[model samples]
Target chain A: MPSSCDEKIPRIEHHQNNSDVSITICGYWSLNSRERLRLLRRWESLVLQWKDVLRFEIKCDESLVWDSSLVVFLRNANRDLSVNGGQVVFLDLPAGLNKLLNLADEGQKRNKEQKQDPPSDGFLSMEALLKPLDFLGALVISFLNLVRGRSVMRWRDFFASARNCSASALPIVTLISFLTGVTMAFVGSVQLEKFNATIYVADLVSLAMVREMGALMVAIIMAGRTGAAFAAELGNMNLNEEIDSLETFGICSVSFLVLPRTLALFVMTPLLTIYADIVGILGGLLVGTLVMGFSALHYLEQTQSALTDMWEVYSGVSKSLFFGLIIGFVGCYKGVFSGRDSASLGKSVTSAVVISVTLIIIADAFFETAFSLLELR
Target chain B: MNVSGRDDIVIRVESLDLAYGNHLVLKNISFEVRRGDCLVVMGGSGCGKSTLLKSMVGLLAPLRGKIIIDRDELWLNGDKKRKETLKKLGVLFQNGALWSSMTVFENVAMPLEIFTDLGVKEVENLVDYKLALVGLAGAGNFYPSELSGGMRKRAGLARAMAMDPEILFLDEPSAGLDPITSKRLDDLINELKESLGISFVVVTHELASIFDIADDSIFLDSESKEILAHGNPKDLLKENTLTKVRSFLERKTVNNS
Candidate 1:
């Protein structure tokens, strides 16, 4: 038996029932007879004879088939015939066997010509053909299942994933946080020196790191690192039909695959935020000591004196947990919903990272707003 | 075709109709598989043949109809009952549909873990026994990605046998293989059927396997969306009124014309 792919050749399949008729001209090249027949049957169901005027074309081999529609060839009587009841049209070969063979050869030559340099003006690969909304919908379903379970309480997978997420992300996060802190201290010192308020630079660094920057920076890093990984893994699984296999085996896809990853992210985010805060504050200290002419001891004293509440560190940690959950959910969801091909998996990974980072920022803003409303400052 | 008294008849599908969106794929389809009988649901492509097998295993919900499996009814009901019904069925998909991530042991052991309360040792012993039954005694540690197509199918069969279900559903079992390999698979299927006494509902258009293993068969007509015929393959071919069936059995091989 030929494989379904082997039997496919470009052709027009037609099916008509009652008033509505449909004709679909498609390249089923490489699909077997069974597949072609199936396509015809599927098209028949789609075009439920709503209008008597319905007509479609199915391209097959060297000629085309038109169903239930009259054909007027531009030249030659060697044309396709439309089937009765708008069912199908078989492109009949010319009467003479020799002429038919010659015509088929010509058609083959033309097909080969078309293939060697396909009209590449515009063609979307199968990956780009998928709708964003469909991908998003798949992602949402995947993400929801990730966050809903008893495994949410486990800190093992969280820490394991966090080590991968945070440890791998540390160099970049450290560099950016350090630069931000240095830039802020340098700018703050220059502006405040005229009034002899350079000491307030300590207050600036502490407030930013503890209240907003620490959790936010850590989440951005995770969105790029762990979130993207989740998408790629899930996308690959989706393409390979691992998720489908799970369903067939009576395994709950959410509980088995998504929960562990989600739980890992949920626990690891806070620790990452803490690491980010320490690095960021040290960046401010280095700038204050070497660049701004403030001693390290003086910087520490001012930072302590400026802080009045414990909520500053606590709040950052709290925000990290929320952002972590969001990242986990979005990452897992994108992966779960990704299209079932390598290209789709790549697209899924890209979209997962983009969506996760965007959400993290949006969530950070919301936290900031809520914290401010409480008058924590 | 006795309608009564056998403690058999594991699956009875009656008046089944199924559709996808605006298209009706199956219309008023009906069939039954006796316990321990091997049934091949054969048809041309897109004739709702695979879909009918899926409906039997409760994989796809029908538009209107009833499917009774081991006395449990499925149709027009909520998803919960339908899922419970599915647990009793073992499916071997067309592509072998094994999880690439897990080893063969894990794949076979999954059903045991989910549906049965058998402990790990018992499950492991059972998994080994099933794999050996399919002639895959030492391949349990290998991932699906590592196995060849025939091996994957055998592994899938091993996994399907894990739960020891009453009904086994296979879609296109001999679809992509050489004649000899396909024959081996058919032989294995026959052996399993005899030893386990489990009912089988297979979907395939493969001619040789159809004749070799199927105790009964059903033909679906794509044009009419109805059950065209059902009975022993030999009798159907001898008495078929449809030119399509005649051509199919004779292997005259229809062209694009």
Candidate 2:
């Protein structure tokens, strides 16, 4: 006494009408006609034991629903029959025909209404404003949560994150920092040699490296390279619902994912700044001794004396720390707040890098202003 | 056999309305799930099945109405209350959303590490036990990408079961799987439901999986965007108010064969 009421059409018979198309569904039913009607109303599609046929009753507003030339598509491995209703169509089936008819009525009503009121705005424009707001709110919450959750350091996780962010970043950071050093020395040599202050080039390079230039250069570089990457990786994961899945498993998405990367960048950024400082100074020294005709010893002597202040060193380190926080927070924020799709991830990552780098530069300007006003440098 | 009764009611979602702009995804949807009961939500794509699941979990807030879990009204907002509600449930996503970077052991152990005061050894043992429960004992060291589709699903199941939640939500757990594999996963779901004594609300359009495991189910009509019928799957197929449900069930049986 299975309750399925199935109607079967012979496989060999294809119903044809003068102008209207015939749709046949083959199946079997155990119920009586009245019960069959109830069951068919409940289930729009039928299940048959052997191959069966079903014929569709078609009507249309445009008279195209009854077109005999319409294509019949077999889907789901010949289990589904799809009829395309070109302009307008209403098909009488077991259950859904009534609903379709109602929809058609509704459409007709809307069409009439649209004609009456032509100035009506479509719904899509509202969505445009709301989506970015949604994204921004999620981003702010994600960033604040990460900050409040734990310490900005997780040693093991930092090591793992650093391997991802810093280790691969070494060659590029080194190259840029090296070039900065060479450029500084070359620029300084031209001016110093005129005053017979050729040896003072070391002093120029040292002062800039220790006080502001080294950290600024490295921070900007990391923001472009690693900050964007963090966003792309984490944002892609978020889009995939991976972060939500973690939450469902009773895992904190912020602690498990965000903390490690933030802590890693916090540690790595300073080390990278220090590395940049060394490379830049050496480049300056290379240009001074080789290109500017100053002795290596003379350049070394000036750098040693001019850059020995602890406060100068501290300033460079402190700026790196602040820069790291900015990049990490912005990158992780973008990642966790990414919408649930690939296109959203791409946009988030792009914004993460652009916003982070811009913020870092602004903060650097603030640093310059503070140091100058306070006479700390 | 342990069966669910009235007192076993776990989650009750009442008069839920969910919308994004003017597009109403779920309209006044209401349903109840009891402890030790398997409630399946069967619907086509864009029929608001997943949206309903998300609302119940408090991941997506309903535009109107309430969700009560174990007779307690779970807050859809407020940080403290949300965390408390979250602890009572576990979810397995459609794609097995395992963190690709972490090994299976880490993925399963994540919850234990986060919410518990357990020591390292105890956490490890707990993780291993959960993985073993899902029949993935020695595969703990493998990353998610290394596992096959079925194996990844199993790992996700293990992770979901790691916390021994009072309620479980699975989104399309058998999607994209072969019939045999899908059946195997459904069998695992059934075993977990019986053994854990936890309520399960699974969102799926896979009729075979639903019929095999569902104790009670709801069918969503795509065109009308409403609950066409709700009851035991077997009974619904027999005496549904909507022709769509009967047709869908019949189609399911034919295709599975």
Model 1 lDDT tens row, B54-116? 667655678888899877897656655766767788888777888765699988987777667
Query: What tens-digit string does per-residue lDDT give for candidate 2 at A49-71?
Result: 11233333332222112111112
TM-score of each: 0.73, 0.75
- RMSD (Å) of each candidate, 1 decimal: 13.0, 13.1
Per-residue lDDT value at B89 in model 2: 87
**Interface RMSD list for the candidates:** 6.2, 8.4
The count of backbone overlaps in candidate 1 is 21
lDDT of 1 by residue, A1-377 (tens): 12222333434445555544444444442323455455556545544443243343332333332221112221111222232334333343323433544555466554422223422423365544454345445445645744564221234444566577767777888888777787778888888898998889888888888778888888887888888888887777777556765665556666567666766777778987888787887888998899887899999888887667778888999999988878877788888877666877888788888888888888888888987898864
Identify the CAPRI category of the predicted complex in candidate 1.
incorrect
